[model samples]
Target: MEANRVDHLLLHFFVIVVGLTAILGKLIELPADQLVAWRTLAAAVVMGLVFYRVRFFRQPRKVILSYLGAGGVLGLHWLALYGAIKVSNVTVAVAGLSSAALFTALVEPVITGRRHSKLEVAIGGVVMIGLGLIVGFASEFGLGLVLGVTSALLAAIFPSMNKRFVDQGGNPLVITFHEMVGAFVVCAAVVLGRGEPVHMPTASDWLWLGVLVVLCTVFAFWMHTWLLRRMSAYTAALALSFEPVYAMVLAALFFGEHKMFSPWFYLGVVIIVLANWCYPVARKRQAMRQSAE
Candidate 1:
């Protein structure tokens, strides 16, 4: 039980790290594509150096290919996330990303060939209502919300794909490394094909990007993978529900993001966050009832 509590705390810490991505995204001056490209490359290089002894290519060709594919999805997810932040404030983008659970509820059944859970769908509907409220009232951030939602959808896909690879005995770190490489490749190609002259990042930009690559991407991700083994999935899900909350709080404190939104926007954010937190509790209760029966 004590171990569980420690894991829970660690999980929350990692979620906060995840939340910081939005702040970092907004702080960086690079275009979304370039930001993602450099971030991924830096992370890949770091992970490659740290796990230098691992034989990354020893995995089956099919597994390596799967990681590469998932990596592409992961790359797209970062692009969409930063793109949202570029167009909108951190609060709007983070709020939209919070809808990942709703997307997962809808996508998981189809991917796993399981019957859709009515309760899950109902909860997802509530989240949709919340998102609708945001879109309706915060019309200025409509495009950012759209991009954020796209990012959430891609977030759902890559995790689902990663689970398959992990279940096949693939090393999580190696998979992450390849995925970073994949993201770098895709983003680099997109940036190059745009035919825009690339402006080099200033020294300050490199400092922020380094923090993002090391702390937010590599360290946080590694902690998440480690904690999942020690805590209940319910615990992790509950902790993650607070990511947008953390982001909003940080935004308000640092960037004054709260001043940019109407009261109704906060209401919508509350609703989405409540739905995220409640779904896990609801699932736990349902599981208990099933076991009792």
Candidate 2:
């Protein structure tokens, strides 16, 4: 972590930004799909400029197309996430989104042709237990819960695909640019199909969307891609586990009345987060023991 200190800081910062993205999204008051379209478009332009300036934009055409596919999935992921918030409250949305790690645990091995680590599986189970407490005991049974779970599932697919895409030498900025553009395209189609009025933002709305694009999406995506280059998928996922916890805190600050939960809420979230944190450590020890044997 020390050797890659910059990467670590960036990853944590990315999580913080990602956590607050929901709060910012809520403030915009646009339909989930429309909001995401604008976000994708804004983020794409920001990332495109970065890619163009940095000389890191080069990638093969096939790889670029692969990233476009990944971006399509990403577009869906954002919709599901925002939809979860619209259908339910942030607590349920955050809880459901927390399951991304669980999905990654199951998907990484199958997608990457690697055997599932026992430690990752065990830790993932514990996190699920914590989430179950958040859901079954603390949250109401409702459509929000269902949407949240769906959001998690969508969240899982894109990141896993991203790991694979990058592993195949895909350019991170290019991939992000293509993906954001793809998301924007898909979102535009969706908005058109529904005949929804695309609300032009007021002053405050523009300010919030600016934060969403610059801090949350652009900077966060750059950090995420940078981390992917420096860290193992499990390490990255473990770090990402902190995101929902951060989101919950931000949710409390912004939407306090709506987000207030029982004491069990914090306890349960802590358990889930700690379990995720332990996964990398546990995996390291296991590998060390096998080597010693």
Candidate 3:
């Protein structure tokens, strides 16, 4: 098989791995804040071993502080994600998170100061209709959907922030470690402030959390970046957008979550995913039309 083909397969595999985060969040019996605290702490400790030899931490204090602040965003992002799952099922949570692809269209330009693409704005209209269907029909999960969309909005900002660090000659691994440490600090503080002890993971929770830390976060991030190196920017972005679809499919398989939704809810999901998948093709065609003209 061709190398790009192999990369494509690996890319989807990583998407599947990311799909697991929502599932594990549902399985683990902990509050969202503590779960994030534990996840960030474990991830930071593991990344610390990798960081001990490399001095990416040697970047200027200003940049280090910025990544740490950004880590707070990452921590909040996960908190919202898990919160969505705890309040609703994984299907609704991922459906809400699906809006992230559209939110990226809105968020990225504002962050990067690039002019908005008319095509993306048009795509957002379609996504909004899908979201309306979700909101109107699955209204019971309204809070969860709101948090999921909030998570999506935060997800949109994360990469643009990381890109600045990468441009500043900081390695991704080091940047991630700093973010993890930052997130752990924020999450731990929140956990402590709640007047509850930092809850230890149950044996079953530990099992799920282990899979989460090992496969969903670390391995998924490594494989995603590795696949990006081998594929075009467009292919990589497109591959990542399919994550919601994969997550929904996994939810159905694992939890029979499909039975809980009305037809309109599924219709909304289809619309969002289709709009996401269509954006790249639409952009490419518009580029071709402009070039030919």
Top-lDDT structure, candidate number? 1
Once superposed on the true structure, which residue ranges of model 1 sit more than 4 Å away at CA? 1-5, 112-115, 227-239
The 10-residue segment of model 2 with minimum total lDDT is 50-59
lDDT of each model, Cα atoms only?
0.79, 0.78, 0.76
lDDT of 2 by residue, 149-172 (tens): 787777777777777777777667
Better of 1 and 2 by lDDT: 1
TM-score of each: 0.91, 0.91, 0.90
Evaluated against the true structure, the overall lDDT of model 1 is 0.79
**Cα distance off (Å), candidate 1, residue 250:** 1.0
Off by over 4 Å in 3: 1-10, 223-241
Candidate 2's clash total is: 0
Estimate, for each residue in 1-293, the C-alpha lDDT of model 1 and write its tens digit.
22355676777889899998889888999999999999999999999898899887787887777777878998999999999999988888877877776676667556535567778678767877887777777788888989988998887666656545554556778788888888888888889999888878889899999999999988876676555445433345435657778999999998988888788877877887788778768978999999999
